[model samples]
Target: MNSPGVKIHHLDGIKILDLFAGPGGLDVAAHFLGFKSIGIEWDRNACETRYAAGLPTIHADVSVMRESRFAEIPSTVDVLAGGPPCQSFSVAGNGKGRRALETVKKFIHRLVDGEDEARIDEDLRALDDPRTALVLEPLRWLLKAIDTEGRDPYKVIVLEQVPAALPLWEVYAKLLRGGEGRLKGVKYEAECWQLKTEQFGVPQTRTRAVLVARRPGHGAIAPLKATHFPFDLHRGKRNVAQAEMFPAEPATPGGKQRWLSMAEALESASSLENSPVDVSRLRRNGRMEFFVVSNYGSGGDPKNRGQRLSSEPAFTVTGKVSRNKVYKSMAEYEADTSERFTIHESGVLQTFPHNFPWSGNDQAQQVGNAVPPRLGMHVLSWALRGSPPSDDELVAAATWPNTPRTTTAELRDIGCGDQSQCPPGSHKVTRSRRKPAP
Candidate 1:
């Protein structure tokens, strides 16, 4: 019953301004829920992707945002949604917490206390990774929205980033508090949760530190609880809590958190026409099943890449996901031409609309960097506990513009940025519907 089309909550006409909005994942979610929104992004490819997807966009650097940025928008915005460039603070990146975080905090506290704005500018220039300072830009705008003329108290605030940035959010919650007691009465209370996308029915596993702040008047924003569970490769290999199972129709009854597996997720999109793929003789839900080909080794070699069973959630689909080998096991074992996941398959793994017009040049980076739109739906649902969208709308949003589709043939023999380092059989596809995966 918990299908993609089954909207559990409605945004209820909220206006959203998505900063650093990569490829408009939040915009897609907002549009599906009927929320009025605009996205500002610096990436040209991502902006084109947004435009092609039929979402409104302002292609500009978020750091230079002036008070007049949102002046022309007809309605007052209800939510301030942002995900600043997180690379500088990502644990995966070498720049994690390299003194810039402390500087960022100092800037945030000062800005919250209404200090000399010029000093903050000076500190930004001195930071290690100036990109990290972009995180503070939201606070700058929040301060302006509150102190300057003609702005209303933002009804909600939503933000996300790597887990390393949790401390920044904690400070943000304090600043967001309406005086002191959020339990009693507050304009908004901010809280962050470490969320796993796999737990939200995404075939791939991705964790994001999420923040949601909501003002008084409506019910408190509910903490996002996982709606699905991590699927097990070997059914009896591990005993997981019933709560961790994905709830299915009949097969697994009683609220089991049956996580979607990669095979099931991509089954509809599988095609072995031009490329060689050894489809396993196994069958699930009336379709041929094939094990994923991967470089992952169970021996725990940190240097070597790892693999995930088609029956289990995928590893984090990075910008290099295409380069991650996805093979058809050779019969009971398979692998001649190393199979690669098409852009559409990779995008769907991130829970973007299956046919989302990825109208950009760097398709891999666009899909990898994007906020999974399904994750967006889950987060917003928790933030707005209201009427859900009609199943039709959800389906529409997931499959809209049905063009520039990626196909099995196109993904064959693609090339990565550095062709020499590109994965075997590397293939590339342009954004939009020249081909389709599903």
Candidate 2:
């Protein structure tokens, strides 16, 4: 792909504040897009990761922080972006969703109140236990506060969440547009878009709902266009030569289809490292026994490696990956043991460049929960570019860097500290030692 002339400083000196800045995914993208950014996150580990990446961050609960405190932030932040926690809205969380919505509402109220301690506290108490409505509520208040101060500090507010939050978009839309919500005077119109991560160059097929709002007077900016190929065999436009697909049109106004495959998302690169398992040990372990002699593809032999599907994008990454199971074809599985997606690999899939360090589990839940950094980068690019690029322009943009291949032996020998630790039974091999000279 050729580099486009679009510059990162689309807004030229705009400032951004990211809430719920998990591991700096959005913040890193924002910086690359040329916005001066400050991230607010409550998780210590996430904060550390952000800090280590050299991104400025504020560690605090959005619920407790007063709106006046936001004044402590720049008076003219050009953009406010974040994805509030969506557990309450999730099907697993059930009816508690209302309470969660309320928590978001309260948080918006406080932000609008300019951090009035009394009001903030009252809003907090108003929320029922096991509820988190305070989260979205304060942002409502913050938006209004920004407007009332006569500084159109935030040109855009991007709210990203799981599909369950679709219903709440109208609620936020109303609140921002100065309708039936407590946040008055913050008149804005919102455009909602849903995207599968693969559509944005992420290997995983994770889908997220995004709401983009701008103050009423600003000329309308269309919803962001998808940049990655869709998983569907039939739908949208197809690139016959590249063999890329686009997402199908939404079945309903707000619904979308499944994700993409791994091979389709990544470009081919030489294998840099290998971490072969002890076949005997794997056979002994019931969990991995099947993999010992499993066929990965048309390449039937257990000894010969299989190949990854280069034409398709990857499956959604998760934290609960089983040692023996495979997401792609068996032939693809035999190609490389490390090819079974790891957390680091998943991170890369999310568009987090190699430089961003992640700490914690190497499992499915963690991987699945992460926002694809590439998607984040794309959003940041939109915010920075001020205008959306044409479909042709977006397609012409650069894909992420390829993963450098290396052998586990080479990695360990070079002392690359962040290298994936060897799995069970693969003790570090050492040359025989000579008898000590007497």
Candidate 3:
């Protein structure tokens, strides 16, 4: 496929504040959609990567920023976006956040009730895992923006987390839509849904719970529509139970496309060979087919490791993605472990550019944790424009960085520490007082 060579759209005067913005996944999409964005992140490692990529970033703990430094943030934020840390709620991790769901909901109510910050923090500290409380930070920022004098409420809010956080997002949707308590006079159209990444053309089967809220005036917010058919692990054939749960829908021209497969996303695949009848077959596209052997196993059985064909979307890319091995054939798997997916390939599977400048330690972790930029493009288009992104915009996202656009000099550093220690070409981004066109 050739580069789309589409120009980046800059929605003048519209800005985004991204909290816990790891490695600029959503920010990249926001830039593709023509919105300026500043990501607030606490991880020194992720910040290093963000800086290397020329993604504007503020390196600070969000919890600390909330206490005494929210004033440092730029005042004209139309969008609030983030995916708070999800280790506590992730199915792969300890279920501390899952168990504390009721507790977190009560905390939201407390925030709605106008509870003191110190009091809320004190209670949040008592939770089994404090990271669970971080989920509420978006609400805090939203309410503060609404209630603060001289500050307009955010025109829109976008948030995403592991699927387990859907219930929490539903709570946010309810409060935003219902206008309860401090939200009483506020007007927002809100929707929350579980987004399957593969349906949006991400070459992985990750699922995320997303919330998009905007002032009613923008347009009635609609559930993000899928642009591709869902992937079936069974490939072309499905057993009775699978058939019932996931009905097949073939791809058609000018309609939804088939879920993108790993072999299609990565160009480094070895030559194809028909494996055993039990092994999944490659799609008719005739690309070099491969399969993956996960380090981890299904049903917690180490002996029964999970496996997937390159013709299918990959299993959810996790922080330990580097440990998963890829093989061109069953013979290759039996002989010895083949090479693992590179960090760049993993990022591509997550719908980031093949040439995305990744830096810092735990690079795999950064790619694994990112909100798929293509998925973000869909959600952001729905939130801001109340429709799916145009084909040109989609092509732009896919063919990002046809040429480097944002130079380090153009970025306005916000809340970054020690200008003397800052990287070369660092500068401040200032905005005009004029509001964006509605």
Candidate 4:
């Protein structure tokens, strides 16, 4: 049977440098799969989160990092992975409109060479950078630099972002070809696919565009295959070809995807006690309110009730937050029960395992901003099949830490003493455990 986790034998020792690494979700997964990882993140909170998780991190803006510094990167880097900030390309953001497009170009230029000198020069000459054209000049610069140095340092490059980035792929493909006859036999080919996280065994449905590029002479790289759940297929949903499905097993027969509920993501706890939650406000919402806790739900048609959902895979987490509304009688005051989804739940849904810690708001803005670690691991395992090791390899190569050995009461007691302690939905204790008489 196919295992839910990536097979370790496929990924023994690999090294990765994560650029624009927000909160280390991708780095954490690479670590779990036995690859070494070095993260570059500009955000203070994200850098701190990575450090706390025991991962090596660089706190400088990737735009400012010198090209010569790229040489400083370990020689054994097998993969270069990152999710550049995509606000300029996101549908919800102003990127689609004119003003935002300028921001996008500027962002790309900055990514290539810390300063927007080219755009600044253009503005001085033409008064404005055209808004409609996709800006990919920086990527061209980086690729050319790598080729000129005769350093094919990385075997593979995984660039992940919103679906709108499809246009940028063409620009990169041409750049890799390098000035016609100048670099003969140095060819590059790439493939892109729109992937749904839930299709890969996550509970939520999130679709993202993944672009994978390989240098000339490397073997074929396979796109990740979905392990469909039986429940989802019974409702007439799409299924992987029978030939591709993993063999059946006792826990998951017929390669069915595993199902996890919001409760499971929340550690299946009964209540959010001693977490300083406002109980009076919670009680005011009616009986159903107890069961109507905030969770990662579907964004599909509200009218389609019978559609089978695959809870085994997670959905592509986005930056949009959920707004909850409650209906009441004409005589009573209506309550806007729209509490933001907690950051912890969002992190769990993104497949960051139970112990990953996040610091910031308990809203979608923070959680959705993260790359699901489980999905990242799936991709890294594929890339690191054969590569040398580095310091970051220690983390990428480690397995999930052993589960906590403490009991519920002991955990609660520890949490009660510390105000900002315990996972969400856990309670606190008033007294310590009594010692037995000798």
Specify the highest-lDDT model's number: 3
Q: All candidates: CA RMSD in angstroms? A: 10.6, 12.5, 10.6, 13.1
Q: Which stretches of candidate 2 lie over 4 Å from their true place?
A: 1-14, 92-95, 98-131, 134-138, 141-144, 147-153, 179-184, 233-260, 264-311, 318-340, 360-367, 383-386, 389-438
Q: For each candidate, give its TM-score against the true structure.
A: 0.75, 0.61, 0.82, 0.60
Query: Candidate 4 at 329: error in angstroms?
Result: 15
Per-residue CA lDDT of model 4 for 203-275, tens digit only, reads: 4556666766666576666666555333233334346422224332324443544444333344322233332
For each candidate in the order shown, give its overall lDDT on alpha carbons: 0.64, 0.51, 0.75, 0.49
- List, residue by residue over 304-373, the lDDT tens digit for candidate 1: 6454566677777767677666544554343254567778778877877666777758898888888887
Which candidate, 1 or 4, has the higher lDDT? 1
* lDDT of candidate 2 over 1-438, digit per residue (tens): 111221222212437777776776676566555567766666545644554455555556554333434544555476778877756665434546654664555465455546865666675665554445534543653545555655564667777877767656655665666633335454667767677777665665567777777766656657676644465543233344123343434455544433444432332111212311122222222322222122323255655532223344544443333232433335544565433444544455565553244543333344455566667766666645655434453332222222223322222222112323222222344689999999
Off by over 4 Å in 3: 1-14, 235-254, 268-287, 297-302, 399-415, 419-438
Give the TM-score (vs. native) of candidate 4: 0.60
Model 4 C-alpha lDDT versus the unseen true structure: 0.49
Report the CA-based lDDT of candidate 2 relative to the real structure. 0.51
